[model samples]
Target chain A: MTAAPAAVEARDLSKEFDGRTVVDRITFAVPRGTTFGLLGANGAGKTTTILMLLGLLRPDRGEAQVLGHDMERDRFRALQRANFSSPYVSLPHRLTARQNLTVYGRLYGVSEVRRRIEDIARELRIEDLLDRPVGKMSAGQKTRVGIGKVLLNDPEVLFLDEPTASLSPESAAWLRSFLGAYRDRTRATIVLASHNMPEVEAMCDSVAFLQQGRLLEQGAPRDLIRRHGKQTLEEVFLEVAEGDTGRQQGPGDLA
Target chain B: MKASLGRIGAMMTRYMYLYQVSPIRILELVYWPTFNMLIWGFMQEYLRSATHPAVFAASYLIAAVLLWDVLFRSQLGLTLGFVEEMWARNLGHLAVSPLRPLEFVGALIATSLIRTLVAVGGAGFLATLFFGFNALELGFGLALFFLNLVIMGWGVGLAVCAILLRYGLAAEALAWGALFVLQPLCGVFYPVSVLPDWLEPVARALPATHVFEGMRTVVQDGRLDIDLLAQAFLLNIPYALAGLAAFLGAYAVARRRGLLMGTGE
Candidate 1:
């Protein structure tokens, strides 16, 4: 079998708002068929970077490519194969789950749109909620529907913005397994943004720590723990965030 | 070009379909047009009972009452469309896509046309049933009158939508108030003969005043005064073009400012 290229790649990507650089020049790569968890506190610019990757925001300098298409130019082809989901943004409350899914399916130009809708609805276990109005559904129900919409197109790169924010522990567990299975089946690259270190350690192939729009460190969970000489990933997160740990080498130093 | 057009078509179809399916939006569509029709219909009754009235008043009344929404409802249609996007926080979804500003504007413009047709058809049907006057008074003059009303109405509506996008839902009232100014100034409900001299010049500047006045003059009198028609055309074309520029300009500004927080929070 042929080796796959990276799902997402950035080279010295930067973004500025009114001359204030919010996203500093940073470079990273996530291989195809792997999940990259972005860890950061509030206002850490994780959201901004995700938005830029999705082509919702343009960088002032540098470049990013998503799903092998340039983020700045040729983004339509990139966006066409990609889909994003977040709890903060909602679907039309006036429509039933089926109707909402159908609209997005048509937007994606997905073939067998109805079948895809049905399949996702069942996968999300939202079969009963299909007929009910979106606004009338509970938060958990909405989240489920939101996730279902993202899957409708079988996106090549699925970006999740705080997917489990309001979800119960049980629901979160169920969702993690569901997402894992889906990724295994489709080889879809995922970018998960969350503040929870434990979830990132469990779900991600590699976790990238972010703070103040800068990537502090990136590595596999076990490797990070070994490097930090910590008992747990949470301790490793705190030490690195607090500037007590990280950087085994100095300026001009290489491993 | 073909792909962009296809995407535009897809977006337009989904919006229109969703509009028809949404009960509240459809209700607003019906409520606003009929609400104004009732007021004008009453005014028509009062004019009929008054002293020797302007001849061909019935045609003027029916046409004005039926087409007034071209000014308010079409613009309001676009405002409401954006408002829906804002409320659902789906603006991000659209913003991230490879959607061009042109395609977005095309979708909005097409919606305005659909909304205008619905308003015109609904009000015209009501007027014909209630006043026994025709909405479709097709003649050489009537065609030009229609050209003036629909085209210019859409342009004004687009300009209003620009304002709505910059502001928010609380400002949707401007779309309604737009009619208040245009109806009187345009002489849609009355003859320009009655408007005061000072106000007449200002009205002359508003293309709607010329549109409704010209429509009334033609459909009622069966005479197309080339000067009046030309005045209407001259005024409406620039405003419509200005409206188009304003729409694209507003979109650009929104993009640059990053004010597109769909939640409006």
Candidate 2:
């Protein structure tokens, strides 16, 4: 049987800052049309890995490719097919949401920009907030608008960094559902970096656990839990994050 | 190329939206230029009666004020354009998009040109209304001088942006102060020869020095000094190229060091 195509691939991807390694020689592959979660604690090189994949930060050693394009040599081509959304970053505050969306839509070279914006606005249920300045919007409203902005390109791959970081549980659940539906409809690959264990388990098809710039364990949530002899993914996460690897069992090694 | 243009227009539209939404932003653009023009106009009126200069004193000072603003506004426009993205925490968003670094630079230059035009245009009008002096009298020479000064400003501004990118917000003060450091050396209101002998060569190396000298020549001799204009362009080419190199170099360092993230205050 043929293997699935990789939507994103990194080989010995590494980076260091000020003589300190922030991203060790990490390697991973995310298949197309799947949601792959990058689970890690704070300062675990999650954002750094995402930036390298997006070509915003170059890897000090090794290489990455997104949608078959080399990130370093042909980043623009890959970027054209990819979009990123994060609640931490913001759109320009002085401009209205509509104006902000229009600018990003135009930047992505979207045809019929206004119509596309209206369609996304409807889909995201952010029509009322469209004309309001971004600075005045509630956190939930801004998160929705940010999602709308990323969707303007109809990107083939989406990178999300702590997308639900500041969101309430209800809003976070809604966003997760929306992302799942969007992924199914578009068959777009998604790379999600998050600390929410439940959200990652519910939304991600596969997960990679990172600790201190290294990939400690990676597999489906159930597979990881079973291999660790843990009852839940959260416990598995803690076990892996806390260097309890002696308790970890390989696949099919479960007693 | 077409995509580049679209992206550039998109950036310009972003700033256009900012200017449209806030009257204060638009007012800030014109305020300093107009105020400086008025003060210089009054000073010129006094100099006109007190000095027995061959050229009309009002003509010289008004031209100085108007052209000097062309330089200042161009530099500030480019610096502030980058700063605005930093303020909004939008640099990360922009970097991950399909926008190339070259396209980003193009947009900044295009925005700076538009800003320089508006600010200087407003001040030029005020100069005419208040002092009855027409800066356009410099004729076609005005375009060459303006182009030279704007290029020089871009060179300086790009360097300042490079410093900011490498060092983050702590180096932001250089954006406002760097250009002024060149002001006295550029001989904006005087001649290069008027400077100290040791400083004369340093002054001559600056393209704006030749521009202001060319302006003075046009005001006094009523003829364009093609030699000065040629010298200004020659100096500008290398300076602008160096600025571009510095910015690109700094960007590489920033990316390698993971400095691009969380750059905003």
Candidate 3:
């Protein structure tokens, strides 16, 4: 049988700043409708790689395609079908959550923007906080609003950077469940970059670990744990990150 | 282009929402212009009485104040718009969206135009009430002069934003200070001829110099100097183009350096 096409594909993607490499040559492919996790510690270049995939940061070498569009040459075309969210980035603080949603909705060219905002707000259980200024909302509330903003366009590909960083355990659990359900319902692809090991293990169908800008290993969470002979993904993560280089698989060897 | 409009309008809506929520923001926009108009009105009255026979003294000063605000407000509008995104840490969010850099800059220009109109409108009203001078009395020339000054403001504002983009907050002072540096050089309140012989050519190089000189012609000669207007518009094209290039260049550097996410506190 023929293989399904990739929702995201990168080949030898690399970046450097001030003579220090931030993202080394990393190759990976995320098949359509799958959840792929990018796991890395601080300065491991998770955010840089995500930015490159989104075409917000140009890679110094190699290339990427998202939703089958070349990220470098046709990013706008790809961007229309994708959306991103991060706790580090925020909506205008002074605008009410509803206003923020409306503005982003309009920018994404969504029809019936108000209705879409309402639907997403309802789905995310943030309807009550919709009228509150984003600055006044709690971190958890802001996280939910950020997710709602990403969902406004019903994107085919979702790029998330530390999406649950500031959420409470309950909210984080709820988000993971919601993302799983959303993925199943729409068969959409998700590229998650997170430091949350448990969250990655639970939500990601496949995971890639990065160490100092290099792809240390990649595979299903279970496969990685088994290969590293670890009890959990976090232990495997620690093993890879701390330079306990074992028989780890390379890029595109996830299967 | 249609997408550009949607993105641009969305950006403008973001600022409009800020203005709507904060009465202080709206008040701030009107306050300075109104205050300047009031102060200038009294000064103009003194000049008219002291000069005794000069019919255009009050009109000239009021026109200068009104036109100067147009330039100032337009520039501030664009710079502050960018600063707001930085302050909110929203640059990364917008960067990943379908909004192109050109569209983002276009939105800043559109937002600046709106801000310029509101501020200049308030000041012009104050000028009319306090000094009995209608800057609009300059007729169609007023529109041409306003366009020239605003375009020049965009040029300067874009360049300042570029500097800030590349250098971060340490360079933010340029947003406010850069324009003032040009104020003396542009002869906003005085004739370019007043400058030393060595500096006259430097003053003449600024589009605002020709704009202000054109304004003086309208006020004193009671007729538009098509040549001066043409020179102002011509000079503005290069300034505006340079501003655009500078901004695009800075944006490229910021992207490559991954500086967009943390530009503001």
Model 3's lDDT to the true fold?
A: 0.90
How accurate locally is residue B221 in candidate 2, as Cα lDDT from 0 to 100?
79
Separate clash counts for every candidate: 1, 0, 0
Candidate 2 lDDT for residue A129? 96
Which portions of model 2 show Cα errors greater than 4 Å?
A244-255, B53-58
> Tens-digit lDDT track for model 1 on B1-265?
7757765775676577576566577776777678677777877777777845665355566577665666666666665566666666666767765566667767776776787777767877777787776656546765666667766766776677677667755566776666565666778777777988888888888766766776766676666677887888898879889988987787656654555544343
- DockQ: the better of candidates 1 and 3: 3
Model 1 misplaced stretches (Cα beyond 4 Å): A1-5, A16-21, A244-255, B1-25, B53-58, B98-100, B140-144, B179-184, B190-202, B225-238
Please list all clashing residue pairs in model 1, or write none if there are none: B186-B209
* Candidate 2 collision pairs: none
Report lDDT per candidate.
Answer: 0.76, 0.89, 0.90
Ranking by DockQ: 2, 3, 1
TM-score (C-alpha, index-matched) for candidate 3? 0.96
Docking tier of model 3: it is medium
